[model samples]
Target: MKCVVSGGNIKILARAIQMLSKIGEEMFVQPQEDSLSFRSVNGSNSSFADITFHENYFSYYAYEDLDESDSLKCKILIRSALTVFKIPSLINKQIETCHIQLDANSTNLCFILKYKNNIIKTHLLPILDCETIRANYKKEGTVNHLCIQPRVLNDVVQNFQQNLLEITIEVLKDKILLRNYIDETSNLSNETRTQLVFGMGEFDEYKINSNTTITFCLKELRAILHFAEILAQPIHIHFDCAGRPIVFICKTLGVESNLVLATLNPDDDLGSQSTTHTRPNSVLKNSAKKPTKAKGKIKSLSKTVFGKLANKYPTNTNTEKIESSDKISNASETSSPNNNNKFNATNSPRVNSAKVIASNSNTNKRENDNSSKQNAFSSLLKRKSNQEIHSPDGGDKDDLVQNSPPKQPSKKAKLIFKKCFQTTFNPESLPGYNNIEVEDSGESD
Candidate 1:
């Protein structure tokens, strides 16, 4: 693929390359029968740029391999390409024609610049294998579009701070607004807020089907504005709501450039400090008056303190069991035919504590006299045998819950075995326990 750029158009081509370099590090060069396309995508993958130079933009253009299935499509470093047209001002007087060539089998992209007084400059930049970079976007049928001279918009942008990173545009029925977009994550107290309002009459052509706001990076927009100013053409902007890409289109004699930039979505910062900026002014007022997380923290602390106190001073289990037994006995007495009193002594709130204590002691003595280690062991064995007989597999009831190795015992089983035979078993009877005890006793001796 070979194309010759005349001296008159060299400046425009250089300006194009310079503007592209600010966006991305590499540029994709693809040749077609009708036009040559240069595309670049920024490092963050959020911005994309494409410039198509028609055949008329070049003095002489030829591509013999256009019929081939695999045409010459490659990428070169933007730095190398920028060097060719480093000084656009001098190119008009010193250069006659710029010839760019890329062969199918060649690894280098050759540039032959013919200079005045029979002087010549040649640069061979190495090419890298790359696929065509294309961004899928709809530039038409958008609800918001504004077309104005580049000089006018550039003047408006100049009023903003030089170091501003992003700008927000609010589209209304009667006017348009441009302002510095302060991020929610930033320190709002330290940042200065600036906003500019322009009436619809200020634009050459303005059409708005819906009112909305969009925020995008100012770096790319500034670059585009400067390039449009150089080309001496109006910039056509088409955008939708936030979180969608906005397209900037510039057209002059034979050059057409398209820039697409992603916009910020306020929903992305919903739960952060930045939410105030995205919400309505009325909501902001309410938000300011509302309390912070301190109230929630106080409630949580109260809950935790109460919970710990409840766990520390537990209810009396012994008194609860005695009260339940007393109620049962009173109900039986009232049901008997011999009962004559309408009010019983036990029904009173105050009870005789000595009588209750004596009765509990008597019951404890009776239980101790009847129970034995052998009887307790036999009872436990009988319960185990009953469980196995009732079970399908003749195994412990816990086996039903898990058939795997290392099964977990049930809560009922643990409760039934607690302190059952602790006094009867002698730790020294075990071989390991006896050895440890003998060594300790020998040392003492």
Candidate 2:
């Protein structure tokens, strides 16, 4: 591929390179059948510039070695390109023409510049492997359109500080406002601000579908404005509401330049106004709904577990208590009458028997069930004179037990206790307590 930029358009090409250098660090060069394309995108990828030099723009152009359908694209450092066109004023006065060529299999691009003094300078820049850079944006049907001369906008931009990074533009139905953009997080006392207002009559052509405001980077805009001023053409601006990309177009004899830039919406900031402020609130609502669902599940589980326990344990507890008390009364009445007579006598013989029981308890730590039964009977007779025992049905316990008739064990009760007394040895026949000699009772005969 080979192309030559003539002496008249050398300055124009240099100014285009200068504009591209300010926007990006690398340049994408694609050689097509009709024109040569130079594209660049900024580091943040928020701004993009595309310049196409048609066959008529170049003095000599040829690329027949490769097929028309094939794509031959290469990437070169913007700084390398800048070295070839260091200064536009010097390039216009001293350099006559520039010849750019690239071989099909070569890794170096050749830049040959001819001077008026008949001296030639050549630079070989190495090609880099990189992905193609492109931006997708719409240019038609924008809500706002302004056709203004380059000098008009340039004059207003000059009033702003050179160090300013961003600027805001408000397009109203009757006028336009330009001002420096200050972040809300910064200290306002140390910053200086400037505002410029222009009426609708100031623009060559003006149209608006709705009032809108936008904030974007100033460096790229300055580049586009500089190029427009150099071409001596009016810049066509097309844009919509905030947070959308803005397009700037400039046309010359055979060259066309299109620049697209990203804009900032004021409402999208952390603590800005409430216009369209539902994103953060919706996020908080979604986060808050999760815990309530878990709590509901836990409450439901607790209710189900309590219900199961209530069904397992029935509510007829009083009947069980009455049945148990009746069994105790019948057992007491059925006890041997001789054993009761011995404990019921209130004489010195009872006192002597208690002393013998105390002596036997002290001598023997382990005793049979017969001795335990005797102790229990004696304790009951002693407490009878002091406290009256009440049955579950509100009857006197002692009278009920004494009047009840002795009852034989039912078949179920005998079967339940048959294993307990199956041993051949009888507990009652053992003569430890049965052999105890007692004095005669002191009843008057």
Best by lDDT: 1
143-214, model 1: which lDDT tens digit per residue?
888898989999999988999887878789989878786543454456776778789877888998888877
Structure candidate 2, residue pairs in collision: none
Per-model TM values vs. the true structure: 0.62, 0.59
Q: Candidate 2 — which residues are off by over 4 angstroms?
A: 66-71, 268-445
Tens digit per residue, CA lDDT, model 2, 320-347: 2211222322443345342222112111
RMSD of 1: 31.5
Against the true structure, candidate 2 has what lDDT? 0.62
| Best model per TM-score | 1
